[model samples]
Target: MRKIVTVADDADLAHLVDLIDMLPGPDTRSFWGEGSNSIGSKVGHRLREILSGRGDSSDVDYLAIYVLKYLGRGNRHIPEDRITANLRGASGLPAAGHAWVEDATRTAFTLVTRYSLPVWNGAHRTRGSAWLQG
Candidate 1:
């Protein structure tokens, strides 16, 4: 089954690379494109590989994919609580420190709350919120 459920533009994909890289964990081991030596490119390549189910994945991969799905769905701000809940329920995510779920959540929270670049707070449309207008 396809793990990636959303489509993100190039800018969004770059932002996601930043988000995933800021998380403290094992580095991405996949080889990227020729002459693409930047860390962001490697991470982005790894993410695509995971999404396509063509490479080995870890708990961190699952966490990143879930966050990507949330972002691509037009969520301006990602709730740490919700991400935590989803990570806990995700299959194959080991309940251990090495899983890196906590680290990913912390990084994502910091990015959205402190920097406020990738995730901004505004009157953005959310799922099932259209009822409020009716």
Candidate 2:
């Protein structure tokens, strides 16, 4: 039997993109096709387009697939609250140059690994669920 997974809400999707925005250097270029100088602005623009229903679904799915392929779980489940708390904690820290970036990257990695992966995997298995509708 297939399990149905609800699509992540807009706020959640934004947070996921924010996490991606925090990625450093090569990872940023590799995933987002841009440098870290103004990745946030570019991603923000894409997010706005997406929220407005003017973005490409394939673009969104590409990010989702990347997270699922890299961070998916086998049978273990990680709570979203934990991921949120970690992200919050990471953001709360004082700006320490590259250290903060590293912290954010680590937190983002964990969030994708523990939270986003399952959602993506579930949706993929079902060929998408009702929550996927924009």
Candidate 3:
């Protein structure tokens, strides 16, 4: 007869939940929960509930990293070198006085909101090279 064993420890999960609890609420000055009604916040809140075993795991893996980083895990998906290069490129744009500053702000916002989150979340799991090409 053969015995089957399962690695049933959920210590990492529980620790993750505890870390989530320590995160500041949306009203805090440093809160990164996004807008009250934004999809990001909804996903984040739902992830917390799911990790705590209070909700279902419908989209757990997809949204896990986004909220997990707030718990001090940092982003393991996106390489630090890529992030630094992107920021450096953006910062190097020529400053045509105040208009250039405005353009740079918009560019930074677009990159952070669109490229950074998607890449970090593994949305381009097979096309990581594509993100680097941008």
* Poorly placed runs, candidate 1 (over 4 Å): 1-28, 31-93, 97-99, 117-134
Which is the leading candidate under TM-score?
3
Clashes of each: 0, 0, 0
Q: Please report, in order, the local distance difference test score of every candidate based on alpha carbons.
A: 0.41, 0.43, 0.39
Per-candidate TM equals: 0.24, 0.30, 0.33
Candidate 2 lDDT, tens digit per residue, 72-134?
Answer: 222122222323333334553444323433444454455444444566677556545567878
Q: How close is candidate 1 to the true structure, as a TM-score?
A: 0.24
In angstroms, give how far residue 16 of model 1 lies from its true place: 14
lDDT of 3 by residue, 1-134 (tens): 42221112233333443433433344543334346754337546665555455543323333443443322123443223322332322442333222322333333333234424654668746655777875
Deviation from native of the Cα of residue 31 in model 3, angstroms: 2.1
- Distance from true location, Cα of 96 in model 2, Å: 15
lDDT of 1 by residue, 1-134 (tens): 63332224233334555545434333432211234654335445657664564534232344344453333223343333333333333433344323444544444443334333223344364645557675
Model 2 stretches with alpha carbons more than 4 Å out: 1-9, 25-54, 71-134
What is the descending lDDT order? 2, 1, 3
Model 3 residue runs over 4 Å out of place are 1-9, 33-43, 48-54, 68-134
